[model samples]
Target: MKISILCVGRIKEKYWNDAIDEYSKRLSRYCKLEICQVADEKTPDKAPEALENQIKAKEGARLMAKMDPAALKVALAIDGKKLDSPGLAAGIEKAGLSGISHIQFIIGGSLGLSEEVLRASDKRLSFSDMTFPHQMMRVILLEQIYRAYKITSGEPYHK
Candidate 1:
């Protein structure tokens, strides 16, 4: 199955990019993994909350267009259900067996995902309740993907 991670904003730091690359390479043995980026919304200081919401909605629209409509979408949010490595592995295995040809993981910007994007998702996932920057979250998501692959393969990485 193809696994895609759709996120707002780009990874500008070298360290963050390297970390994401490492786990991405490891995940290739299990499935195709792709990271698709959407432009982060521009906001001026002292902007109104409504403007932030509008930006999020626009970014969500761009992200949704990049995915296959038939693919299972998982939105990563603070309120989403948290899953450990093994649990995530089980979920991924089930998704593959359940006939989902592709799975897309959506990550929003600092303001978070729009309601429309969340509504479009098949599942909601939370890595943690604590908020993380979008760039750092990229590494975390990639590592989890690799860990899930390892668990499914009955490999030592999980230990």
Candidate 2:
């Protein structure tokens, strides 16, 4: 299985990159773990909140285009469905059994993902209802993905 993490914005913090890289390496044993970074949209200094989302939407489209059409898309958003470790493991197992060749996890910019991307996704998952910075979210997502793989493979990483 190929697990691709598509995210908006670069990991500017060294710590964030280091943490995500650690999990990415761990996940590679179970499947291909790839991280795709897209340019973050610039927040207009004078735009209203509604207009801000439009900027994010434009960038979201670019990110969506980079994803493989055959892959199972999972967009990360605050309003998305929340799942625990076990639930995530179950979803991965089902995907694997279903012969999903790839799984693309989309992470939007500061304003969140556009409706089009959300509609294109097979699943929408939220780490929490509380908002997180996009950079931090990358590391968190990577860790959870590694843990999920460990859980499925009977590996000791999860414990």
Candidate 3:
């Protein structure tokens, strides 16, 4: 299986990059992993709802452009379905069994994903109801995916 993390913006901080690299290395054993980043739109402080929507739309367009048409798209949203590690593992396993060779997980910018992006996704997942920094969320998502793989393989790391 091939897993792609398609997100907005870059991870400028070294610590976040390190965490991502660690997970990427660990995940290499299970499947091919790719991290794709799109340019993020600048948002004014205390911006109005309309302006925020516009920014999200621009970012969403960029994400959609990079999306793989044949891959299963999963969007990360606060209101998305919440799943446990085993459940995620089951979903990933099921996808592979069903002949889904690739899965693309989408992480939006600070303003969140646009309606078009959300509608394009095959699944919407939520780590938590509270909002998280998009950069940090990437790391968290990677770790969960790693855990999911471990769980699927009946490995000891998941505990």
What is every candidate's alpha-carbon RMSD to the true fold?
Answer: 1.2, 1.4, 0.7
The digit string of per-residue lDDT tens for model 3 on 1-159 reads: 999999999989999999999999999999999999999999999999999999999999999998998999999999899999999999999999999999999999999999999999999999999999999999999999999999999898836
* Ranking of all predicted structures according to lDDT, beginning with the best and ending with the worst: 3, 1, 2
* Model 1: worst 10 consecutive residues (lDDT sum): 150-159
| Each model's lDDT | 0.89, 0.87, 0.96
Point out the higher-scoring one by lDDT: 1 or 2.
1
- For model 2, how does the per-residue alpha-carbon lDDT over 76-149 read when each residue is reduced to its tens digit? 98888999987898898899899998999999988889888988898999999799998888888888888888
Clashes of each: 0, 0, 0
Candidate 3: TM-score?
0.98
Pairs clashing within candidate 1: none
